[model samples]
Target: MNILPLIVLFPLLGALILAFNPRLPNRLAALVGVGSIGLSALVMVWLNWLFYLGDGGGFTQTLWQWVTVGDFRMGFTLYLDGLSLTMISVITGVGFLIHLFASWYMEKDLEGAPGYARFFAYMNLFVFSMLLLVLGDNLLLLYLGWEGVGLCSYLLIGYYYQSEYNAWCAFKAFIVTRIGDVFLAIGLFLLFTRFGTLDIQQLLQQAPQVWQEGDLMAEVAALMLLGGALGKSAQLPLHTWLADAMAGPTPVSALIHAATMVTAGVYLIARTHTIFELAPFTLSLVALIGLLTLLVAGFTALAQTDIKRVLAYSTMSQIGYMFLALGVQAWDVAIFHLMIHAFFKALLFLTSGSVIIACHHEQNIFKMGGLWRSLKLPYACFLIGGAALSALPLVTAGFYSKDEILWLTFDHGYSLLWLGALLGALLTSIYTFRMIFIVFHGREQIHPHAGRGIAHHLPLLALALLSTFVGGMIHPPLANVLPAGPEGQYGHLIRVLTEVLAAVVALVGVGIAAALFLGRRRLIGNLMEAKEGDRLRRFFYSGFAFDWLYERITVRPFLFIARLHRRDWVNSLVNMWPALALGLNDLLLGTQNGRLRWYAAVMTGGAVSMLFLLLLF
Candidate 1:
């Protein structure tokens, strides 16, 4: 039997068992949940080994035919290639780690409603959906996984249903992403009509032959598909939901928002590279959009006070970089960066979770000061994750992947895009380190009743080790995996120089942040006391009112319009028609009153009148 099916089935079984047995003890449910994902991880590793050994080739396992109609057919097939392998490894690997961390992190919450079993059920379902997403061979199958994930996200986001804000956040995320889904559905229909098939591999094979560069249909398909990608990946115009998604559990934050769910958009683009390549205009648009999002989100991160919100915006900004990579056809490079991002980003969120648990759920970085001594493991892990985010030159995983993306932008002659990305990177460094400095480098802020236990620190220690060294280790193989362009069409020296420039920008950003927030505290303090400084601080702190602008310009007005149309003349017209019909029926039936004498007399008169009228005609 192929190991592929088990990868998805194990999680499905786990979800089923946990959902039915919600009354089980928390420890037992936790054991079942983590064990199931761990088993899946081992199977993925085994499959990887088999794939590597099979004549240096890829593998695909088909369970059965999904559907068939004349010339069109779809199958429940799993395709294992370099790309899918990367995603699976991240899903199961980082996913398992997060699951282990969640066990301890959420133990306290099991005392309330929606106990351990329910939490694990959502987590397991998430694993299964993500697996289906990466393994799917066709677009429709992929959509199934896509919708599955959206459902799981809603469940997890509203896990704490007692909080009205959590439910609202879940609804917001659901509605925002549905906007992208509409475009994606249209794109799939267009692709099927044009190519006569939804199989991604086959579509890729035919796209280059059938569609030339600048083909209108290809461009439309790319744009429509990008609409979905932008929303899922938290790009511009559809990115607000991510900041609010922080209302979910901390492990959910680390697993879904940080590592897996957001990366699905990047994977979609990479998986359908041929379509984008044939649509040059669409690709350029993607790059432009990515650049805008990177700059906007990076700057916004600087203003955030909540630790998770800071990381939330950072996720958006980093994903923008990935989209930029995909737009430039750096498929392997984008996936590589995604892999590295998963390690460090998950580590950061987990460490933050530890810090929050230790401090009894305090999340404001301003409220947290010198925690290095009290929370040594979290401090060390946070530093490791922060270093990666700052792209500390050649030492961090982010440096390897993100630097390559910067290099690609310049080498492709996108000078303005490169400059924008550079600025974004600088802002990323400053904001990332700003949080780090505030939370760990200042005066102690731990409360007296806050709990500190071994359960909280172990995950931090494990993730910290991975965050520190994974980037450098992955670099050698990652470089080889990236596609090399045709000679003379590519610019090698420019690539290297651009990497160096990105590194320099990151360093400078870090330096400036250190000087203001750490190195020259008195100077910054004095500046803060000045009236103008207060205004400037408030401006940045409120994210320059981007969220407010969105509400005023888009969300609030759209809702108002919906309410007006739904309640005004149209609704009245519908009600009036129904009421009018009822009145007409009553008037026509009113003559048949149940009085015997009146009824007999009216019948006799009507019969005589009818006889006279017929005789006259």
Candidate 2:
């Protein structure tokens, strides 16, 4: 009945086995990599069935007490609930599909057999770390998983360690996330100090009793947690690393962008909603940050030439919607969006991977043209994923989830926030269709072929189907399972009108993209070559110059200080004592000459001097 440990252990076991057995053949490694996640997914399915049949309340399974000092105790435990179950379902299910896709994607790594096995090893480890992050019962264990994902991301992102650019991107992802981890650690310490327990359920219960609404301590703690979420979720200022993260393999991009790294922040906020609720100011700040991030990332996506970078920014923007939902006290809606985003985003990235492979690993969209006939499966998959991403009316799952967030924003009286979200929706549709048109509409640039075998196409088909229809099926169940938020007292007519309005905005965006990219490609190209247009492109393309600004403000100053202290004055000062001792030794060397007469003379002189002193006394 306690199948929770198996969910995490399966992937961890596979990672260890693959890692230690470096001699594994490519075939065997692929089997192990894909099998491990598949088994985990199966176990999760079984657990879901059991959870539904049993009591609806959450359950915690403690493996052992991991740390103890006097009254304090921390356990290595797994927590199961509707929220975590949803997360693990996505992690294991979608993660398995990614693993399967990677088995094919990395089949012919330039590094050959060793590199192939190593890639799967890191992927399995990433799944394990992500599983632990969602299922952790205590803050300490969650932090362990938090840092674990960060490590796995660094390893996987730098999969091609030979490339300096890849290595730099990996380091950027690691270092930036670590900055957020520090805040999360501090928040954990604060929580433990306040309540003397790291157990999440107990902390949630105690938080309300000890801290009143808007309390300063509560606000600070909430903000620290928000900082962690910001970094992990790729929100606004901490978001630069994600676009660069496309330096990794396509599957790595899919995993990070869709199921694992970026979604962590949304989960963190949902899990700790109680803390955020206590800090009303922090909650408002969350909404504000989400609004800014969604719009900023949406525009950045428009300017990206690389296929994967566009999806990367889209992931950031989608996660922003989740944050916005949380900000408005729409907890269930946030999780709903997270789930829907995972499906379509993963599909989009995987489809892009197929395109990259078909085009001989070319990622620049401009370099790619009409492939609809040559690569039918990828084209279809891309269309479905793009439609879902654009929230195209009632046909795609994103429409339900995204429209709910937009409606809630307005219903809650945050009209400006709602307007920003509407603008973001329009932008999302534009970029989604824009990329679609650029890649699939123009004349064929190269003959394309679908990736070989069922491993490649099966996941894409499955995810594509989910992206189109999963929203309607999951909504009612998710509503039943998640904690409910306030529903505005709007009539059926008003609700219908809101949905209509959202759909129209999305359609208008798509229409504009179609007309500009599909109908008037030459004119757009000419405009792109214009001086003002070039300047505008560069601004958005560089993530609104945040990276450059950070370089000037943070990176350059730090580098200068490092160079200034390269000689290390403190080290020089420390060496001075030893240098003085050596000098004194040299000065005394003549007195220690290996001669008995010299020693006797020195002794006699000392004795004479002592007698002279006695006479004088």
Highest TM-score model number: 2
Candidate 2 per-residue lDDT over residues 162-186, each given as its tens digit = 8999999999999998888889999
C-alpha lDDT values of all predictions: 0.84, 0.88
Candidate 2 overall Cα lDDT vs. reference? 0.88
Clashing pairs in 2: none
Q: What is the lDDT, from 0 to 100, of the residue 381 in candidate 2?
A: 91
Q: How many clashing residue pairs, candidate 1?
A: 2
Instruction: Give the TM-scores of the predictions, in the order they appear.
Output: 0.88, 0.92
Candidate 1 local lDDT, residue 349: 94
420-504 per-residue lDDT for model 1 (tens digits): 8899999999998889888887777665133355556665666666666564475312232235432323566766677778888
Position 391, candidate 1: lDDT: 85
Candidate 1 versus the native: TM-score?
A: 0.88
